[model samples]
Structures are given as C-alpha cells and as structure tokens.
Target: MFVLIWATFLLCVCAETGLSQKPRVKIPTLTEGQQATLTCVAPGLCSGSAPEITWTWRGAGGTESYITGSSTSFRTKTLTAFTQRHISTLTFNSSAEHHNTNVTCKIRFTGEKITEGGSTLKVNYVKEVNITGGTNVKEGETLNLTCSVESFPPSLIMWSKLGSDITLHNDTGSATLSIINATTGHSGQYVCTAKHMNNTLQENINITVIYIRTPQIIGNTIIKEGDVLNLTCSVESFPPSLIMWSKLGSDIILHNDTGSATLYIINGTTGHSGQYVCTAKHMNNTLQENINITVMYIRTPQITGNTIIKEGDVLNLTCSVESFPPAVIMWRDLSSKTNSKDTGAYTDLQNDSGSATLVIQNVTAEDSGQYTCTATHPDTTVTSSVSVIVSWFSKIQDVSECVLQAEVLTCVCISEGFPLPTIKWPLLGNHKEYAIKTTVSNHTVNSTVSLKVKNHGNSTVECVSNNEKGEAKKNLMIRSVSDTVADSSVLNVGYLEIIIAFLIGVVLSAVVCCLIKKCSRKKTKNSGNLDETLEMVTSQDDPQVFMFIWLFFFFLHNYKVFNCAQISSLLKYTYLVFWFSI
Candidate 1:
C-alpha cells in the first residue's frame, strides 16, 4: 500500500509538469545600429484568459534591468513607446550601443504569480572601419596609412597596431599616420583605437618597408689618348648619408652629396680599369658596393686606290701605313689574282702581319689607277696606299667581208682587224686615189677606199691594223666583167640591143644632113637661073652621093629593124617555150 501511494505521487508530479509546460521561445538576431524586439506567445492559454507579460534585458556582465511591465499587474509587460504596434503588440526598439545585449520576454498566468517560459533577443551593429593605402613601402619612398571609422558624434579615434607603437591624433574623428621617405626600420603592425564614454573598439593593420639601391655611371666606356675621364657615383637614401669613393690607393671624400651618394673618378687610365667602390654612411652604419670596368681603345684607319686590272697586265703597287697597335687587313677588292672572272668566287690572301692584297680581273682602261688597302684592329687603326700600274694589249674584233664592181672588174675586201685598222687602194687601170672613209661600231671597224679601176684583171684590196702587239691584213682578188657574165645570155642580148640602137641613130643623122645640103643647093641654083625656067641638070656627084647615103641609111635602118624584130620574135618564142616547159 505504501509503494502504491509513492507511485501515485510520482504520477501526480509528472501530470502537473506536463500540464504547465510551454514551448521554448526562439531568440531573434539583430545587427548594429538597428532595433531589436522580443516576444512570447502562450499556446496553452485561451484568448479569453488574461496572460501577464514582463520584459527585461541582460548585459555581458550578467546585469539585469526591468524594461517594461503591465500597469495593473506586474506580470503583464507594456511595449516601449518607440515599438511598432503593427508587427507585434509587444515590442522594443534599441540602438547599436546595446549590441550583444539580450532581452527576455516572460508570460505568466493573470492571477498566478509564477512565470512561464520566455524568449531572448539579440542585436547586431555595422561598424565602418578600414585601413586605407599601401601596407608595403620601399626605402626612400613616402609612407602613408589611414584608419577610418564613420560613427556617430562623441566617438573617439586612436591609431595603433599589434606589436607596434600607439599613434594618437586630436580634433579629427579619423586618424592617419604618415612617414615621409621611410626605410626598412619603419616596418611594423598598426592599430586604430576608438572609444566613447564607457565604450571602446580597436582595429589592426600591417606595414613593411623595402630597401633599394640606385647608382649612376659617368664618361664613355671607350676612350682615346689624352682624354680626361670622369665618373660619378650616386644613390638614393633617407636620413641623409655621407658619400665616399675608394680607388686604387685610398678612399676619397665626395662633394655635392645630399640624399644621393656621389663619387668622381678624375683622369682615369688603365690603372683605373680595376674595381670602383662606393660607400654610403648613415648615422654610425655604412653600406658599400663595388663595380668592375674595362677600358676600350680608340683610332680609325684610311685607305686609298683602285683595285682592278686586265689579264696579262703587271700589277705594280705599294701599301703605306700609320697607326698604333698596327691595323690588321680584313677585306680585299680583287679577292684572287687567278680565276677572278668566275662569278662570286673570291680569295683571301693575308700577309703574316695581317695585311691583305685586293686583286680584280679583265681590266680595261677602267683598271688603271691607285688602290687603297686598309688594316683594322681593336682600339687602333692604320691605313696604307698601294700604287697599281696595269698594262694590257688591244684585242681584235668584228671581222666583215664585202664585194665591189666596176665595168669588167671585180674586187673583194676583207676587213678583219682591231684597233681601227687603216685601208689603202692600189692604182689600177686609170683610177685616181682619193680620200678613204672609216666606219666603226662597238666590236668592229670598217675602212672604205675610194678609187677607180678599168681593166678586167686580177687585183687585190687590203686592210691593215696595228697596235703595240702586232699587225693583221686582209686581201681579195678581182675578176673581169666578161668572165663574170660569160655563162649568162641576158647580158649578150642587152649588148646587141645597144649596138643596134647606136647604128640606127647614126643613119638618121646622115639622112638629115643630106636633106639639108640638098635644100641649100636647090635654093642657090634657083637664085642663079632667075630669067628662064625649064630642064634642070642632074649632077653625077649628087646622084652618087644620094645613092651612097640611101644605101647606108637603108642598111642601118634594116639592121636596127632586124634587131627589134629579133627581140620581138625571141619574146614570142620564150613565151611558147615557157608554156611548154610548164
């Protein structure tokens, strides 16, 4: 019975806990500079039941404060004056300063003093904070950094970084720190400190400095004799550093040195060709560096003359010189003395001393002159002049042949020679000697001899050409006209026609003279016998003369007429023969 009673008590306690239990309230999140609201609903309580509500806030330190409560009943909480009534009948509006603060909402029975379950409210804030500008800086460069936090008034701003010094600026809400011409030693972390009454915030930034070196060079790398050499050294620095130069013997002080390190090398020489050191001194420390240099030599050479000649021509010349370290021959004009005519083929023949000979080929008058051969070497130059004398023989060109004719004579002249050969005609028959004309072309020269020839005999025409080398002559034979035309019948026919025409002309002339003389005699006879007219006497001499004249004229006329008739007959026969032949 006692066990049953204990079980009944446990059952009664479980039932009471289950009937009074309420759902756990969910907490709403908030941001900085915004409002937060807390609310609780009693699912077990009916609408007609009057439930009481109370709201309070708890800070980070666990401190609690009464925010609101019902006027009639302390369990019923009233909304704040700034709360919106539309979204919820119970609400509260709070600022960013209350960020992370928790608001608790408790619901209770109207007549019961005990509270039910509650909910929590969380608030968030957006703080505008950033570090502006470059965190890494090179030595000898300006360094600047800024920390900005746009906040409400009465907010304090301070600058600092982790493992760094605290930087403070007054009067401005934003803090900025700047280092002009900074160095590697100025690198560290930076932090910004901002505070208000009973409130404080902080941010951090990192900064690093890079170191660099700059140096300057002076004068020409290549120098001539008696030239003044000047070199200057410089570098970029901060905090002002001392400049000095170390040379062969000792170190020297440099002038005009400010942020830059300047060093000068005066009257440099081969001895100065070694290493040059530049040192920069800042406070008690010094940085040094050295550079190597090599000096170059100076000089230019001159060349003179023509480098060409003809075959079989002797080349006589010399090359003169004037220079230091002696110039070496590099190139030649002719290349080689033999086989120089081959295209693109060249020769390189250098003396043990490095001088070279330039030979060219097939030289005409163009090959005559002096030539210049130059020798080249590093740092110094020398030149030489060669006097080249060329000798060559003239060559023959353009051989031609022609034939001439006069009457029964024929002649052939062979004009084959060079150097413009002279021509002469032999006295033949009754021809007179006259001037000779010469015609010349690129490869050939012609000589024409003007003279007369009357006989059909063997004759020769000659042309001779001469130079420093030797002379050459050309000859041709002449033949008679009859011999030349003996095999042709056309010439014989033409000659016969000429002969017949001549005979006819002579007969006509005789007839005309006879008629004139007869008329004149008749006139004279009439004048002497004017008294009577009758019988006329026939003189025997006149009749005989007339008869002889008539006979002579008839024969001459017949001869001419017969010749013409023969020619016409021959033409008719030739037409018939040609037709038959065809």
Candidate 2:
C-alpha cells in the first residue's frame, strides 16, 4: 500500500509541473512616451469555480509592486472549449525608466492554490544622440567619426553625409564612419541618425581638411627691357593657404595674399632680373617653387679716344656701351662714300663687353670728316661721332711788271696759296707819296703799288707776297730826273723856232704895205690931184702899219702861251690893215 501511494504522488507532481505548458507572457519593445501592452495566456486554468487573476510589476533594481487601477489597465477573456483558455492584458505608457522592468500575472484557486507567469519590459527608447570625433583632418590622412545613442532599447544608429540619401555606416546603438586617404573632396557636413521604434533623431557636424600642395608660378622667364613683368602664385589647400612671392636670395616680399597672389614690375630693367620664388603656407607647413628670370637691355654708345690726328700719323678710337647680352660693335665713317669695312685703311677690334677699338694707318687730309662708332644689340642701336680736321698750305706767285706815267710809278705782284697769301710794297719811302691796293680771287692775291717820283728818281721798289708756308719778293728800278729834263729842253727849242719865224713874217708884211701905199699915191697924182691921193695913202699907212707890226710881234713871241685860234685871229687883223693901206 505505501508503494502504490508514493507512485500516485509522483504522477500527480508530473501532471501539474511537466505535463502542462507553462503560462506564457509576451511583451513588445516600445519607444519612450509610447503606449505599451503586456499579454498573459493561461490554458487549462478553469476549475470547478472561477479562479482569481492579478497583475504586478518589478523594477530593474529588484523592487516589486502590485499594479493599481489608476495608471494601469487589466482585461480578461475566456474561451468556450472542453479545455478552457484564459487571457489577461496589462497596459501602461512606456519611458526610459520602464526599460528592463518586469510585469507578472497571478491566478489563485479555491483551495489556496496559486500559479504565476512574468515577462521583462523592453522599452525601445533613446534619450539623446551623441557624437565624438575630430572634424578637422589633413589631406591624405585617415578620418574617423563615431556616433552613440544613450537609450534603453538600444536604438539603431546610421551615419550619412548631408544632402545624400546613401548611408555610410549602420549599426545598433552606435556606429563609426572611417575614411582612408581623405582629401579636400571629403570636406562637408555629416549627419548621424538614431532610430528606435517610431522615433528618429539626427545630429550634424562639419569636417574640414587642411593640407598644402606645391605652389605654381605663372609668367615668362625671359623678358625684354622696358616690358611689364607679371607673375601669379597659386596653391590648393583646405584652409585657404597664404600665398607669397619673393626673390630667391633677397628677404623682400614682392606680394602676399590669401590663395593666389600676383607680382607686377613696371618698366623692368636689367636690375630686375633674378631668381623668383612662390611660397604657400598652410597648417604650419610651407611649399615653394623657384623660377629664373632674365632681362635683356642695352645703353647708348660712348666714344673715349682722341679725334684730332696729324697727317701721316696713326689714328685710334675706342667705343663702349653698357648692355646685357653683349652688343656688336662697328666703326663707320659718315663722310666716306663707300663702306668702311671694305676699305683696307681701317681696322676694327671688338670685345665681349660691348667695347671696340678702331685703328687707321697713315691718316691724311682726305680722312677729315665725321667718324662714327656704332654699338648694336638685339633691341636697339647706339652710335657716337667725332670730327677730324687737317691743316696745309700752297705756293706763292711771281711779280709781273712795272709802269711809269708822269711823276707816278706803279708795280704789280701776284701769289696763290690756301688760306690766302698777303702782298705788300716794302720799299716805299716817307718823302714819296704812295698808295697800295690788294685783291683776292679764287685763293689768288694781286697787289698794285704806286709812288710819286719827285727827287728820288733812281730808287728801287720791292713787292713782297708771303704766307705761313713761304715768302717771295721782286725789285724794280726808276729812271733819273736828268733824262726827263733833256727831253723837255728839245720841246722848248722847237717852240722858240716857231716864234722867230712868225716875227719875221710880220715885219715883211709891214714893209709890203708901205710900198703898195706909196705906189697907189703916185698913180693917183698922175691920174687926179696929187694932194687927195697923198692924203689917202697917209691916212691908211702911218699909224695902222706901225700898230699892226707891233701887234704881230706881240702874238708871235707869246704863241707858246696862246692857242692856235688866237694866233690865226692876230694874223688876219694884220692882213686887213695892209690891204686897206694899199
């Protein structure tokens, strides 16, 4: 009997504990501030009378409490079947504090028997979205971004760039976004999203890259004189790098700006040529580029040697100019009709520093004129000139002839020379009055000298013509005063003979008149009365014959003093008196 009773007790325990399914509790995870429902199902719980069912709660800290009717709701349902099933539900508003909390359902029978079923409350909620990472990163480096959600239900987190629909990272409660070899293109606003149940939260952060690349310099390296020089410096960076331009060896900064800078040099010269550098500064690092600039220039030529050279002497000249890219030197004679280089009389020697020497052998008067030295460069030509002069002389001419008229004596002399010769009469005496006349035509001089010969008759006169080169002279003799006196005596004797002949003729005419008058009176006395004829002959002959003879002698002696017309008039008067007496 004892063995049968023990077996019966074991079968009853197996039927109550193992043979039936345990009461089930089902609860859903919910976001904060949302309504939640807990369901409890007990099958085969109907006995002879109705059983009591109650609900209770347990906190995550192991505390327990019976649920009241004010903030909680309980509902029960029975199914009509041979084996009855009973269902109970507990409802409440969920919160972060309700996470991991437990809700229990209990049933008590009439004999003081009890059964219970419980479920843990999982509240899917997040209090805030938290992000922790660096926003600034260098180029070509690694970028790390992490996002965490501080919530009870372990919210889903996702990382995405702003204005993009694709997700970069996705995980539960936390997520990390990593980028390898980050560049400037990776810089922008990023969005981190936390999602739980029906709630979604987002946070934004900006990312930037700070890095500098090699700087670029833009301009022509080779430049001409007087041209404007322009150059630009450029760089690529995230933080907007500082750009600066400067010479390679100098500390002076040419330009400075933000991202790009420009350097301008107006009217550049040879002094502006050098090495230039462009530097970019970013994030405590610097990058640079070097450029070489060359300037081409030239200056006016200068002549430094003697210009005046003597005949049959050597001529030397030096020409120089200051220039870059050394100039070509040449010597030219502007007065020469032909090219100077082709003439063998000139020699040219040139150097690399734009200097040259010109040599001429045995210079003559034909080489006198303007000579030029020319320095030529690729951009310009310069020249300088010098004038040369030569001095010389010519020969003098000889004296020609001498002439004499009355008391005046004249002599002529001539000379031919360059720069004109001077002619003079050197032997003119103080007592003798003289005049000298000189003239020049076609570089030839002619001189005439006249002197009054008074008592000094046999004097010698000299004509001298001279110049800086040489001198010449001639002498002439004058006739004596005795020879001139002898000629005058012959002329006086001829005049005396003419006067004696005239006087004799006058005396004979008077004698003829007296005879004719005496004969006429004798004839008249024979023909008529002698007293009337004698009276007529007396009135005609006596005083008229004597007056006519006296007048003829006066005119004949003074014939040399009076003219031919006066002598002829006196002779006619004497003839008229003689005819009247007859």
The CA lDDT of each predicted structure is 0.49, 0.69
**Per-candidate TM-score against the hidden true structure:** 0.29, 0.51
Model 1, range 149-230, lDDT digits (tens) per residue? 6554435677655764655453246767778998777777777776744567777777877554554545454444345545
Q: After superposition, how far is residue 401 of candidate 1 from its true place, in Å?
A: 86
RMSD to the hidden true structure, all candidates: 25.3, 19.6
Stretches off by above 4 angstroms in model 1 are 1-31, 41-52, 66-91, 94-101, 107-112, 122-125, 129-134, 137-216, 220-229, 234-243, 246-252, 256-260, 264-276, 280-287, 291-582
Query: Which structure among the candidates has the greatest TM-score?
Result: 2
lDDT of 2 by residue, 373-470 (tens): 77788867777778765323444443445555556566667666544678767667464445555556866776666565655555666667676756
Which residue pairs show backbone clashes in model 2? Answer: none
- Deviation in Å, model 1, residue 578 alpha carbon: 99
lDDT value, residue 277 of candidate 1: 67
Query: Of the candidates shown, which would achieve the greatest lDDT relative to the real structure?
Result: 2
